[model samples]
Target: MALMITDECINCDVCEPECPNGAISQGDETYVIDPALCTECVGHYETSQCVEVCPVDCIVKDPSHDESEDDLRAKFERIAGN
Candidate 1:
């Protein structure tokens, strides 16, 4: 599944740079994760960097964009131009 930054985000600015897929960005209020670009770091790291660095633990699996590990890997490959 993709990840999402909830309203609980503290805007600490830590998660943005940690996203390997460039999926996290500063939204109008809180940081937002683009489901289209999010791969949960499947092809990059063992864990989601943004989630690891998030201070508030606001990042969570996006139930609305639920995907399997294979799906995430494919998405990551696409993003990486593989």
Candidate 2:
């Protein structure tokens, strides 16, 4: 599944640069993760780099954009142009 930055985000600015897909960005209030670009780092790393670096632990799986591992892998391929 794609990940989401909740309102709990502390705006620590740590997660933005960690996203391999460049999905995370500064929103009006908090960081936002674009579901269209988010692959949860499936093809780039073993774990979600943004989540690993998040100081507030506000990033979580987006239930609204739920996807399987295969789906995430597919997204990664599309993003990577593989």
Candidate 3:
């Protein structure tokens, strides 16, 4: 599944640069995660780099954008053109 940034985000700016897919960005009020571009770092890393580095632990699976492992990998490949 894709990940999302919660309201708990402190706008620390740590998570944005950690996202391999460039899915995280600063929003009007807080950091936001783009489900369309998110691949949970499946193809780039064993774990989500953004989540791994977020000090606030505000990143979580996007329930609304739930996806299987295969789906996530497909999304990664689609983004990577692999």
List RMSD in Å for every model shown: 0.6, 0.6, 0.6
TM-score of each model, paired residue for residue: 0.97, 0.97, 0.97
lDDT of 3 by residue, 46-67 (tens): 9899989999899999999989
Candidate 3: clashing pairs of residues: none
Deviation of model 3 at 1, angstroms: 0.8
Q: Per-residue alpha-carbon lDDT of model 1 for 1-82, expressed as tens digits?
A: 9999999998999988988788988999999999999999998899999989987889999999989999999998888999
Model 3 worst lDDT run, 10 consecutive residues: 12-21
Clashes of 1: 0
- After superposition, the stretches of candidate 1 with alpha carbons farther than 4 Å from their true spots are none
Residue pairs with colliding backbones in model 2 are none
Report the error of model 3 at residue 25, Å: 0.7
Candidate 3 C-alpha error for residue 81, in Å: 1.1
Model 2: CA > 4 A from native: none
